[model samples]
Target: MSTDASGGEATGVPVTVTADAAREALSLLEGEGMDTDVSGLRLFVQQGGCAGLSYGMRFDTEPEEDDQVTEQHGLRVFVDPASMNYVGGAKLDYESGLQAAGFHVENPNVESECGCGESFRT
Candidate 1:
């Protein structure tokens, strides 16, 4: 695993972050006093949820040695190699409405999702 941005160049970016999502994430990071230049959002897939796989995200201080780092809309995103396999070609977006307001991932690799819409199978 290279510490450089080669992971993105090699496999392409696993996910794309929308303007809204980037804005929200940057704001959250600022609130936490994390430097925007060194801190970023970590997006990954974990085994769980009713569909056997669930999406997980959090603020990471920096990318790991094996993490694929990509930047868009003034935000940096980190994705590990294993998780990249399942989330490749996914888009991260933020929605705000009376019914719902949160970050959502539009993943092209999804084959099916649970009824509650919390988990998916690829």
Candidate 2:
């Protein structure tokens, strides 16, 4: 994976996005068949979930000032500074199977998660 802007990981945080995972993300977006040239993919953590944290991803057009951007598989990824702690040392992957498939986040910092997999607590 390549860092976006300044070209590096968070000040004290570590994260990795494998090449295969990146390609898979791009593939899924293409398969979605949207009439859009998605500028990139963005990931963030938000509050108010049952587990205290939730992961959010979107196909975006640009980066925000506080975004820690990263690029992989020709797609830009934006992550907010505040979400760094909640997702520290995490990795994002794309999975596919007959029953399920999508972007999956493997976060080491998450301590607890709701049964529905919609929220997490660190």
Candidate 3:
């Protein structure tokens, strides 16, 4: 899978990953025994949740033919065209705190999110 630089502005990548997120993703990929060069995290939007849309993510051996792949801190992220519509200009971040610790998507496209914060509506 080909990859563009982390800068979304230069590459027109829909989503960008924070340094913390990239580090966590790379560690996860290594733990799974996936080749960092060929494998990546897939970020996509799905129809579900309390609101109209929700985000989903998983590890992929490679990006799909139509995926927009971006590289950040040596970690690759794959975003599909459909998902791009909802997540464009979004930031993927990783936070480790006493209350929460995981990946989070800060999407500018989101108009509103559900009370539970599990879903969103554009």
Candidate 4:
């Protein structure tokens, strides 16, 4: 995979991370105090959101066989092939503010988002 300021340019990489998100991810990973080489962040889309789909992310030490792994700005991100359809081409950002604080996803494929902004429909 070709690592860029935005994210990796890999064939199966479903989502891209903004520079802000990448920096924040690196900080968060460091905060966990795990070996950076083996630990990474995993992003996925799952069923059962108010709008039919929800996004998920977590730190993982091992990746599944079907996962598409990419590294950018010293952060590793993994995305399973099955979740790519819904999140492909999406951009991830990290925002810290009084109103909202966390990772945000801007997905081009989303047709609608729920009122809470926690779920989406493709």
Candidate 5:
């Protein structure tokens, strides 16, 4: 839940959500480019995909009691305790370009991503 620059906490285990990355996630939600009335973004990890783990996300109006709430650049994000381990030391970003567009993750745990980058293995 706590981390410093370079992503290493006191225990040496990286706590995801860099301050800069957290800020980017917020801009994607309420920024001029977003098209949803999302209250906050939820980050989760699921099994399946070419790799063994997959990333899933959605907008939620309310967060669960056990969810961890972190904010960056005024944008709030809800991370479930279960998914925290997998997504720890990761970042949330929005990619917009002629070929690729939408939300992307800069996950440190990720070993490799599928061709489309829709899935990854840790």
Candidate 6:
């Protein structure tokens, strides 16, 4: 992926991965194994949740021909065209603390996120 000051790519199907997040993702992928056929993590949005749309991610073994792929910090991320509209220029971050430990998305396009923090509205 092209490098930029903002994080990674900032245009069309763009996604930036922090080094911490990339390490976490790589560890998770390694646990899934070659037998599971997981090539990378697929990021997308689904219509639901309290805020109208929920972010979803899962292991993807096969990527669609139209999928936009980006490699950052040694981890591969896949984004479909439809989801790109909502998550372009977003950053994937991993946080670990006494209260919470998980992956969080920092999306510039989001106007607000629900109280539960599971969904967002543009």
TM-score of every model?
0.91, 0.76, 0.89, 0.85, 0.69, 0.86
Top of the candidates by TM-score: 1
- Which is the winner by TM-score between candidate 1 and candidate 4? 1
State the C-alpha lDDT per candidate: 0.87, 0.71, 0.85, 0.78, 0.65, 0.80
Look at candidate 4 and tell me the lDDT of residue 50. 88
| Residue 98 error, candidate 1, Å | 0.7
Model 3, span 1-122: residue lDDT tens? 23433323323445788999999999999999999998999999999998899999999998777678877788888888788888878999999999889999999889999997779999
Model 3 gets an lDDT of 0.85
Q: Per-residue CA lDDT of candidate 5, range 1-122, in tens?
A: 43222333423333345555555656655564553333667888888887777888876765676666655545556677777777876777765689866667788888789987778887
Residue pairs that clash (backbone atoms under 3 angstroms), model 3: none
Where's the lowest-lDDT run of ten residues in candidate 5?
A: 3-12
- The residue ranges of model 3 lying beyond 4 angstroms of the native Cα positions read 1-13
For candidate 2, the C-alpha RMSD (Å) to the true structure equals 3.3
1 against 4, candidate with superior lDDT: 1
Error (Å) of candidate 1 at residue 25 is 0.5
- Of the two candidates 1 and 2, the one with more favorable lDDT, higher being better, is 1
Ranked by lDDT, top first: 1, 3, 6, 4, 2, 5
The true-versus-predicted C-alpha distance at residue 84 of model 2, in Å, is: 1.2
Which pairs clash in model 4?
none
Provide backbone clash counts, one per model: 0, 0, 0, 0, 1, 0
lDDT of 1 at 74: 77
Candidates 1 and 3 compared by lDDT, better number? 1
Number of the predicted model whose lDDT against the real structure is largest? 1
Task: Compose the digit string of candidate 1's lDDT tens values, residues 1-122.
Answer: 21335543546445888999999999999999999988999999999999999999999998887788878887888988899999878999999999998899999999999998789999
Per-residue lDDT over 56-119 for candidate 4, one digit per residue giving the tens place of the 0 to 100 score: 9999875666667776667777777778777778888999999878999999999999999889
Clashing pairs in 2: none
